[model samples]
Target chain A: MKKMLAGYDAVAEAVKACDPDVIPAYPITPQTDIVERISEMIADGELTSEYVRVDSEFNAASTAIGASAAGARIFTATCSQGLKLMSEPIFSASGMRLPLVLGIANRSLSAPLSIWGDHTDTFAERDGGMIQFYAEDVQEAMDNIALAYRVAEDKDILLPALSCLDGFILTHVQEKVDTFTQREMKEFLPERDPVHTLDPSNPTTMGAYARPEHWTETRYEVQRAVKRSKDKIGEAVEEFADVFGREYGLEHNGLLETYRTEDADVIIVALGSVCGTIRYVIDEYREKGEKVGLVKPRVYRPFPAEELNKVLGDAEAIAVMEKDVSLGYQGGLAIDLKSALYSNGSRIPVLNYIVGLAGRDVTKDVIKKVVEETKEMRGKDPSDIGLEEEERWEPLREELLPGDKDD
Target chain B: MKQIRIHGRGGQGSVTMASMLAKAAFETGKESQGFPSFGVERLGAPIEAFVRIDNKKITDRSQVYNPDIVIVQDSSLLKLVDVEKGLKEGGMIIVNSSEGPGDLDLETDAEIVTVNATDIAMKHLGRPIMNTALCGAFAKATGLVDRESMARVIKETFEGEIGEKNVKAMSEAYEVC
Candidate 1:
C-alpha cells in the first residue's frame, strides 16, 4: 500500500485506480510524466481506456470535453502555458457541466519564460467555473484527484474540477504514498452515472448558445451550483476519509486547513507545497514559545472565505504568503483574504508576502523572516508598515527589479 | 532528519542517485524524500539533487540548503561549483575521484571521503555511470544505509546483468571506502 512515488507517479496511480473511460495525452513539463504513466498503464493492459494522442493541450481539453459529453468519466492533466492554450475549452468544459477532473501541475505563466512551481496557472483560471483544490503534498495531490472526481460528478454540483499540485516541488519529489486498490476506490466512488449526456436518440443540447436574455440566468445558475457545492464537497471529503482512511483539513473537513492556530497570535495563510515548509517554521517557533501557526487553504475556488475568517480572524496578525501576484495589486490569496476579512467586519492586520515565484526557493529562513515581520506588524494599521497597496515582496533581490542605476 | 546533496553533471545520474539513496533509506524502514534541483538541466551541465531521511514523515518541501552530507559524482564539479556550499561543519563529503582527499582542494570543516567510482563502474559496467558505485561509497562512509539495503535497491533499479554489474561496482567501491 505504501510506496515511494513522485507526485506525478502518485497522481497516475490515483487515475489508474479511478479508471476513467478516456485519457487525452499532451506533454508538458512536470505534468507530462503523469499522463505518460497513464498511457503506459493503458498500453500494458492494466487499464481499459481510450488513450487519445493529442499534439496540443487545446486538443487534450477538447477531447476530454467530447468524451465527458458522451457520458464518459474523463481524466486529463496540463499546466502553465498549456493551461493557457486550453483556456477556451477549459471554460466551455465547465460551462457545459462536464464532470471532468483536470490535474494541474501548477506552474508560473511565462513572458520571460519560466518552467517552475507557482499558483499562477490555476489562479489565472480561478473564475472559469471549475472547482479548484490545491494539494499540500504528494499524498494530498493523489487524494485530491479522486476527491475532485467524487465532488465534481455530484449531480447537483456537476462542475469540472481542478486538482492542482505544485510543479516540480511535489511533482518531482519522491515520497511515501499510500495507494488504494481499485475495488476500495470503486466502493467509495462508483462508476460515473451522468445526469445528462449527448445522445442522438434522446438528444439534449450542451454548451448551447445563450442569448442576452438567458445569459444572466445561465451565469446565475452556475454561480448558485458552485456556491452550493461547498456543502457537497465537505460531505464528499468526509465520505472519502471514511472510505480511504485518510482525513484532510485540520480541525474538520472544511475548505481550508489550520495548523496549531487554536491559540496562535500570528498565522500565515498559504496554499500547496509551501504550506509544508510553513508548518515546519510554525513547529520551530512553537517550541520557542512563539504563537506562530499556519492556515492552508486546500480549496481555492468557492474561495473558502468564511472558513478563512474562522481560523485566521482570531489571530492578532495574519500574513498571506503566496507564489502568485495579481499584477499592480497584491498576491491573489492575500487580496481575497483581505476582502473576506473586511466583509466579516474584522480589522486584523493582514500582511501580503509575495514569494517563491518562478521556482525561487522559499526556505525556512525566508519563513522565519516573514514571521518576524508579522510579529512587528502586530496591532498596526496597513499603512504603518507601508502596506497600504497590499504588496510586500519578501526576500526579493532588489537589484533584480528595475530601479535607479545607483543606490 | 539527515539531509544530503548530490553534485554532478546533468547526465551523471545525480537525481537518480538521490532517489536511490532515499529508496535505500526507505528499505531500512525510515521515511525519506528525494528530488532534483529546480534547474533547467541538459546533458553535461552541472546540476544538483537532494535527499532527506527522517524517523517521522518528511514534510518540508524546500531544497536541502544545509546538507548533513554531500556527494560529488564528478571530480570536475569540484572546480565548477561549490559542492560543499552549505554542508554542516562536521558533515562528510564522498567524492568520486582517483585522487586522494589531499589532492582535491576543498576548504571545509567537513571530513572528505574519496573513491575512484569511475574505475569501478568502467570495470563492471563498461561505462562511466558512477552513481551506483558512489552510492556504495556513501553507505560505507556514512553508514546511513546498510550495504544490503543499498544493493537491494540497486538491483531493483537496474535489472538483470546490468543490475549485477552495478552491484559488483558498488561492492568494489564499498571495499575501497
Candidate 2:
C-alpha cells in the first residue's frame, strides 16, 4: 500500500526505518520538520535512536561524526547557512571516512538572507570528498537516504554521503512517497560490521596527523576511496531497486535521463525539482510538434561527462538551467555541464539560463520561452551568438503593495 | 490523479494531516503522495501540505498547482495566501473555521464546507491542534476516504488515550461538519 506524505515526513519515516543509532541535527528553515519529527519519534519511543538537539549545525555534524566514529550508524540534516557552518565538520567526517549520511535541504545562502530552495549551498561543498546525490522529489529523497547509508558504509567506499533536496520546494513540500517498512529496509541494508571502530577493545586513533612522508599517500587513499564511491553508489542503487521495485538507473554512470530528445533541435539540461517543470514544458512542446527535450543530470558530482555528451551530442542547441549562480562566474551546474561537453568536442551552442533562484517559481512558460529563445539563437553564427555572454542576469522583482514607499 | 492541498500554520499538524490522509487513502487501496511547504522555522507562519491520490502510479512531483480539494486548517489564510488559486470549478474547499459555509464570502463557485475543528479539537483533545479534527471533516466532506477508514488510520497513527481522544474528536467533527 502506498501513501502520500510531506517530503520531510517521508525523510523522517525513512530515517526511522533505517534505524540509525544516532541523529544529531540543528533545525533550520524547511528542514526543521524532519528533525522535529525524528525527535518526536524518539520521545514517543517509536524510534530508539539517540536524538541529539545540538547547539548548531557544526555541533550536529560533529556529534554525528563522534557517533559514527564510535561505530554506530549516524545521521544529520542541515540547509543553507547551517551547512556552511557545518563545513569544518563536513570535511572532518569525509577526511575520517566516518560513513555518515547527511540530509542536505539545499537552500540559498544568505546575503539578503533568503530561506528558500537553491543549489548554492550544496555547490559550495562540491569538493568536500563526500559523495553527493541530488534528489528530484520526496520519494527520491527518502530512497537516497537509505542508499546513501549503504554506500557510505561499504568497506570499499567508507566515505560520508550527502543527499541534497531543494529546501522549501522539496523539503517542506508534501508528496506521495513509497515509505519502506522497517522490515523491508532491514532486508535492503544488512547489519553494520564495525570494521575500524573507536571501541575500547580495539583502540584505534582516528584522524591522526601523519608525517609529510605519508601525508600524500593518506590523501591519495582518501581520493581512491571517494573514486570507489562512484561504483559503490551504483551498486547500492541497484540493490535498492531490486528490493524496492524502484530503479534509480545509478549504474549508468554518465546517466542523463533524456525526455523526448529524439529528433529534438533544442534540449534543456537541468537538475533537481526544476527538471520536473522542464519535463512538463517539454511534453507540452512535443505535443505541439516542436522537437524539444530535457536532459536531466541525475548525478551532479563526479560530473557525469560522457553520458551527458552522448545524450546532448545530437542536439543543435542546448539550454542549461541553473537554480543557483556563482557570482562573477557562470552558474555552477551550467559551468559543470559546459566542462563536461568541452572535452567531448561537441560545440552544441549551449545557452545558460539561470532561473528560479532562492525558491522563485519557474513556470512552464519560462521553460517554454527558454526553449524558444535557444532555438532562435541557434540560427545565428556560433561566434556571434556568444552563448556565455548572451545570458541576462536580471534582479528578481520584488512584489510591492499598491502604495508601498519602498518601491 | 487526485491532488489535495492543505493550508495551515507551522504549529498546526499539516504534515500529520497529510500523512493520515495518505494512510487512509492507502488503506482504501489507492496510491497517495503527501508533502508540506514551510517558509520559516518559526511557529504560526503560513505552511502548506499537499497530497496526491491516484489509481495508477504518480509520475509528477511538482506542487499541486491545481487541486481537486483545498483543505484550509486556518481560516485566516483565506485572506493572506491565494487559498483558492487553482481550485477546479466543482472542487471542494474544506475550511476548519467556526464560521458556517454561508458565512464565508468566497468568490469562487466551488463547494464550501466549514467545520469548527478548533472547537472539536480543544473539546476532545484538550488542545488547539485541529489537524485530526479537520482530517475527519475532510473525509466527511469529500468522501475521499470513508470515515471508518480515516478513524482507523488515526487510531493506528496515534497511541494510548490520545489516539482514542483523536478518534472521538474526528467522529464529532464529522458529525457536526
Candidate 3:
C-alpha cells in the first residue's frame, strides 16, 4: 500500500513486517517513536511480538543479543548516548554472529549533550563489527530493514546489522512510503534461518572465550564476514528489485551510489541524507555547465573502497563531505575515504568538508562553497586537502556560510 | 515548488500540522515532505517545522530558509523570533489569533490572514490543540491543499468522534478565512 509516514513510523512498520519475535526497546528521543509505534501495534494486536521496555540502552542491546542467540528474530533501536551505552553489546552481538537488526537514529555524540542529527554516533562504532547501512530517506529506511535481515541472516554472513538514518532529518520527517503485503514481504525477506541456536537439545556456546592465539582469528572471522556481507547485500537487493521493482544502485544492491561522476572533473563523496542535499547542489552547478558529480556511500561498514577507487578514478579531485569528526583526527568519513583511496593507489586530491554537526544546516550554498574549494585544488597533491596529523575542524559550519542562528 | 515554515512552541502540534499538510498535499497528487527542527525536546520552547510541496520529488534536506508561506500557531512568538524571516515578498502568513489582520502590524508586504484557531479548537474540540484549526486556516489562506483534503487527513489522523470534532474545528476556522 502507498502511504505517507515519518521515517520513524516507516522503520517501525518495516520492523513489524519482518515479524520479529522480540523487540528490546528503550525510549530515546527521535528513536522513541519507532518503539512507541511498535508498542501501539503490539497493544492493538496488529503485531504479535514481545515488546520489552528495558531500563537502559545497555539492557536493550543485551536483550537483542539474548533473543537472537535463542534463534529468535530480533529488532532494536537507539541514538547518540543510547548508542554509546549499547556499544559493548553491539560488538558482542556481531562477534557472536547474531542475525538481528538495530535501527540507529543518528545523533551527535555528546560532550555537552546535543540531541540533533549527526553521524558521530554511528561513525564511532565503525570497527565494532556490526554491518552498517546508511539510509538517506524513508523508502531506504523501510527497504534497508528488509535488506538488513536478508543480508545479515545469510548463513555465510550471520552477523548483526545496524541501519543509520539522520536523527530528526529523516526519523522525524514525513515522506511517502510504499508498503508491502505479507505475501510480498515474505517473498522478499524469507523466514530467518539461524546458523546456530542456544537450545538445551542442540546447545552451542556463543561468544565463548577465545585464547590469545584464537583471539586474532575470531576477530578476523568477523572482519571476513563483514567484508563478504558487501556482496550478500548486493544479492539481497537484486532479489529485492525482482520483487519490488526499485533498484538502489548499478550492478550491485548498493555498495555506493554515483551520480553524474562518469565525466565529472570534481567528485563529491558523502553518506546518509546529506547526499540528497548534494544532489540539489550538483544540479544547480551542472545547469551552469560545471563538471561536478556526487558519490554516496550507502554501506559504510564494508567501506566500498573498490567502488570508491573506481567511481572517482577519472575525476580531477575528490571532495569528502560529512557531518562528523573523528575527534583528534579530522572528518571520520574523510579519513576512511583517504585510506580507501591510498590503498587503492588513487593519487587524486581529496578535500574534506565537514559540515552540519549538532544539526547545523548544510544548505545548497554551503555545498557550493565546498565544491568551489575542491575545484581549486584540482591537480594539487591529495595531501593538500587530505587529513593532517593534528587537526579538528568544522568547515562549512564554522568557516563558510555561518548560520543566522546563534549556537 | 511551494515551501511553508510553521512556527510554534512545543506541545502546540506544529510538527503534526506540517505532517498533516504534507499528507493532504500528497493525497492531492503532489510530492511532499515535512520535518521539524531538532533540539532538546521540551514543552513551550520554540519549535519550527517545514513542509514542501512540489510537482517533482524534493531533494534539498536543508531547512526552509525562504518560504512561500509562514504559519504562526502562536501570535506571541511573532515578537520573540522573526516569524517572517526570509518569507517571499507579498507571500502570506496565517496567524492563530482572534485579532484580525489589522491587529497584526508586521512590516511586510506579505498577505496576512488571522483566525482565532485557539478559540475554535477549544470551542469545537474542548481543548486548545489549534493545529487542525490552523490547517483549515492554511487551506483557505493559500489553497495549497483543498479543504476537503484537510478534512480527510484530519479524520484519518484522529479517528472516531475526536476526528469528527477536529474536522469541525478545522472547517469553522476555514470558514472565517
Best by lDDT: 1
Write candidate 2's Cα lDDT for A21-50 as tens digits: 999878888788889999998989999998
Report how far off residue B174 is in candidate 2 (Å).
5.8
Off by over 4 Å in 2: A1-3, A19-22, A40-54, A66-71, A181-207, A210-217, A254-256, A377-395, A398-407, B1-23, B35-37, B41-53, B56-87, B90-104, B111-143, B157-177
> What tier of docking accuracy does candidate 3 attain?
high
| Selected candidate, larger TM-score, 1 vs 2 | 1
lDDT of each: 0.89, 0.81, 0.87
TM-score, chain A only, candidate 3, equals: 0.95
Displacement of the residue B56 alpha carbon in candidate 2, Å: 4.3
TM-score of 1: 0.97
**What DockQ does predicted model 2 obtain?**
0.37
User: Per-residue lDDT tens digits of candidate 3, residues A1-407?
Assistant: 88899999999999988899999999988799999999999999999999999999999999989989988999999989999999988789888888879998998877867888889898889898888999878898888899998888889998888888998999989999898778889899888878778999976788889889888988899999999998888888788888888788846448888888878999998888988889988988899999999998889888788877778888898888888777766787888887888887888887777788878888888888889988997988866754443232434234556566867
My TM-score estimates for the predictions, one after another, are 0.97, 0.82, 0.94
Model 2, position A406, has a per-residue lDDT of 79
